[model samples]
Target: MNRSDMNNMAGSPYLLWRVGSLGLLAVVACVLAIRSFSPTARTRQGLMLAWAVAVVAIAASAFVVPEGVSDRALLNRIDPASGVKCATSIFVLSLPIVALLGALMGRAAPTQPRLSALASGIAAGACGAFVFAFCCPFNDPLYVVVWYSVGCAAVAGAARWRLPRRFRL
Candidate 1:
């Protein structure tokens, strides 16, 4: 397919999936940051910082990686279109429920660091899966796992670092 064809393929559904996943990641990261920084005066500020950092990290990674990597013969074995559908479906189905569960559990036990981490991990996994689905036929699964994991970790680390002392449970 030509460049125009590729651009056309990345239309509404793809945009929606990408935007939705990013939004979900932002929400989850914010929640985790808030939980970590509970009782702090700068909780909101910290969350914003975390969000900014996550966006920068994702953007940087995308910019550095060449699109040609996804067009390899082995990578093309998987249907990118179908993969995107699967990933998007998984993300849409999982994020809200996981977010809700995190909120409920967080309210009940605000001091649980492990719980917060688990929530962050779930969000990361969802994002990774979605990215992998869309990037199929053009990238290796291993690359997806590695880069996505790194992206999620960067976000989670930023959230954790910005946590307020009162919320450091």
Candidate 2:
């Protein structure tokens, strides 16, 4: 609507990516929550749907990385020490929430515990990463790829590991 606002948006190309990525993640999380918790036939169709959601989430998150940046440049910008810390912290913070959601869903769907757990894990990871994108000022493609995405995945893995113990009826 205004020139200054337009200028700011133009300067921050990653804003578009952030908005789109978060929107996509939100949708994926909801879809996963619904399908994963529902009692359905443990068939190939269901598994394929889960795989599709996972793949879409991964691909969408990857696109959050800026384009036209060379690998060398990205690598040079990487701060492995800080990145690890950031990723770890985000994952650790998100795990409990993810675990709680998984547990609630798992109680209802005892037929396919693994599938439900996987869906919840992936959804939780996406949700966590999306939230991180807002606070993280760094729009470096490498940072988004390495820490944010990996953080989501780490949360997912941790959730999966804790699935049986916490979700068991």
Candidate 3:
């Protein structure tokens, strides 16, 4: 985005928090997944920790709506079709990252590659949805809950479905 656009967005405290929180979770998830899937092969505990952190972060993001917008405006933003579209696009965009991470985590647990795949998917999905905070102009908390949070989950689900087959070793 342009400098002016960024400045405008930055003016909104809620938007900043929304992006920052999700971004933090995404980074943490990826870090933990990488650690667990590394050559040294950390335990599943790291992956579980990452999943817990991501869940909490997503839950918290539900409250980070843009502060100045009116309730009417917020309500108007609650179109289910648009939310679904937005979420689907986000999930589609994140697939490559999820797949790449899954491949990198190849055979982390020979008997349970699914765990690594799941972690990689969650990381990629969270990061992908976090980017939507920049593009989405709506400051509706409900919007964030439906589109951003659920979108990340959809990405994770999609990744779980696709990654195992693609990354099978």
Candidate 4:
């Protein structure tokens, strides 16, 4: 579609709100995951593994399959053809790297579990934003912040739930 058509597609306020809410959820989930882990070396390792798996899974899903129709409809509000491929690529490349870095940093330092998770989440968000800059160039900033953030959070939450009780916060 033409530029105006693209603009019209992406101008919905509600879509922005939905994406933002999801992003916030992601941040909360990350926090929860970190807190769930025990304050031990093993728990730290577990947390790192959890974040890594979640990031990889979400990023792969973004490309291997179309985002959920509901998600697309929301995204289409910003760009009828959101650059799904680019977004997926960025997510796939950046998330693992960031998670790994966070894991290593956490391992080497005396950071708290919650702090480590939050740090990783922030890194993930930054990577998401970088990916969005190239992929969904026409979409609203809110969409990027929300959907990507939420995706990260979902992974973190799932990891927390799956971990054994001994490792729980």
Q: Across residues 19-69, which tens digit of lDDT does each residue of candidate 1 receive?
A: 454556656554654454243334344446555655654554454344455
* TM-score leaderboard ranking: 3, 2, 4, 1
Q: Which wins on lDDT, candidate 1 or candidate 4? A: 1
Evaluate model 2: give its TM-score: 0.71
Q: Which of the two candidates, 1 or 3, achieves a greater TM-score against the reference?
A: 3
Pairs of residues at least 3 apart in sequence or in different chains that clash in candidate 3: none
Error of 1 at 18 (Å): 14
Alpha-carbon RMSD to native, per candidate: 12.8, 5.0, 3.3, 10.8
Q: TM-score, each model?
A: 0.34, 0.71, 0.77, 0.38
Candidate 3 local lDDT, 36-120, one digit each (tens): 5655555377667776775676567556655454456544767777888778867876777787787776645434456666667
Rank all candidate structures by their lDDT, best first, as comma-separated numbers: 3, 2, 1, 4
Among the numbered candidates, top TM-score falls to 3
Clashes of 2: 0
lDDT scores for all predictions?
Answer: 0.46, 0.63, 0.69, 0.44
Candidate 2's displacement at residue 49, Å, is: 5.6
lDDT of 4 at 142: 36
Best by lDDT: 3
Worst 10-residue lDDT window for candidate 1 reads 158-167
